[model samples]
Target: MRALLTTGTPPTWTVTEIAPPAVAPDQVLVEVTTAGLNRADLLMREGAYVPSSADWNVGPDRVGFEMAGRVRAVGDRVTGIAPGQYVMAQTGGACAELVAVDHRLLLPVPDPQDLVAAAGLPSALLTEYDALTGAARFRPGDRVLITGGAGGVGHIGVQLARALGARTVIATTRSQDKAGLLRELGATRVIDTASEDIATALGPDAFDVCLDHLGGPVLAGLLGAAAPRARIVQIGRLAGTHAHLDLETLAARRIQLIGTTFRGRDTDELHALNARVREALPGLLRTHDVRPVVDSVLDLSEAERAGQLLDRPGLTGKVILRIVA
Candidate 1:
């Protein structure tokens, strides 16, 4: 099996042979076809991770988070999964030819023909799904706001909010060139952060809920934009974590600023959350209403190029690395 290794602290792609993962009775062995590149992958390359993840050394077996593949085999305890089913999943490591993951996390691809795009869906899907549908307590007909709308999770967040029946969906991006695409995707309004101030452009108390990924200065803007009692789910800190917020406004409006991540969750908690996503996904996917934005597809041999693509400023959508294909 060939897998990509991370040269610690300023990582570079280095592929080498590695043993396939051992399968547990409750897991499935997948023949990885494509894997998605995430910001987390870049952070890992820089030797950054949760302190507990020290054992997750920079190596071939520790580089990927999400992948799409065909089921090569299922463990004895895994029910309803059979060989040859096209699926996608987020596992501890997935940049290799084969990966073993819990059967419950496997998502059956709605369109097997689009498996390459499916490789990028799991992480963003789970992140925004949980943030909007769970943490933000999204309601149909509510006015929604999605910050950083051109990125992988942000673009999909825009579509999902619309799919869930939001009366208005506002998306933000640093690039004006992407505003048209964001509107095409589902945004009722697209804010070009490059030229407009998010707070002033959006006006006050207009949005009922917000799924915010860029949590620096944007956080302050989202606070003013949210309606009374609005829920703002902070899911990412791409724009730096520090922010200067107005405590008076938050208290007066009864706005609930919530934070979320799967980082500290246990297996049972993740499985439960994923189950909810799994239930709603098939219907949404069938409609072709919400899908991953794939920026580029490169062979696994071009992992370094994929890394460069991932870092391109204002890059929209996931960079996929084809594994078996």
Candidate 2:
């Protein structure tokens, strides 16, 4: 078995042979077909992101966070799911050819034969579902705003906001090249932050709910733009962690600002979150109304090139790592 490793202080990933993972009674073994490269994978390389569990601290003490594949073996306690079933899961060490995953984290692949697309769905689906519906507590007819709207999780956030019946869905991006794609995915408006003023573009008291992944100045602008009693959920800080909040505006609006991260969650909590996201995914996929926007697909061995691609600006979707069988 070969797993990707990030070795050194600055970090560089390379495939290295390793012993296969052993399954526990509550776990299943998956023969990985494809793995989605999340921003977290890029952050982990720089010693910036940490996995939820130490079990992932393998070679150079890092691992892949999400994957889609076929079940190769099942634990005695696992039922209803069988070997050969195509599945996607949120688990550590997913960059490897095989991974031992808890059954509760499993979601059936929407298209068993299309592993490349399935590979890009898990992380975005789980993260945004929890952020929008669970943390943000989205409601129909509400005006929703999403920062980094063309990103891996942001694009999904756009679709979910519309599917749930938002009156208006506003997204922020660095450029307008992705505006049409975002609109097709359900975004009612796309704000090019590089050229447009977000607060001016959307106006005062416009959004009922806001999901922000870019912090810093972007977050400050959102704080001032939020409607009264709006719910603002922070899922990422890609723009920089520190931000000066508009305290006066926040107080005037009675806004609820929340910060969410899987890093602080326990395994059981994540398993439950994954289960909930899994339940809602099939309906979206079946209708062909929501699907992952794949930016590029690379062979498993091209880990370095994949990382470089993710670092580029104006990326529109997920980068998938396909393991050739």
- Residue by residue across 70-137, what tens digits does model 1's lDDT show? 99999989999999999998776678899888887888776789878999998888888889988999
lDDT on C-alpha atoms for all candidate structures:
0.84, 0.85
Model 2 TM-score relative to the real fold: 0.96
Q: For model 1, what is the alpha-carbon lDDT of residue 319?
A: 93
Ten residues in sequence with the least summed lDDT for candidate 2 = 53-62
TM-score of 1: 0.95
Clashes of each: 0, 0
TM-score of each: 0.95, 0.96
Off by over 4 Å in 1: 51-61
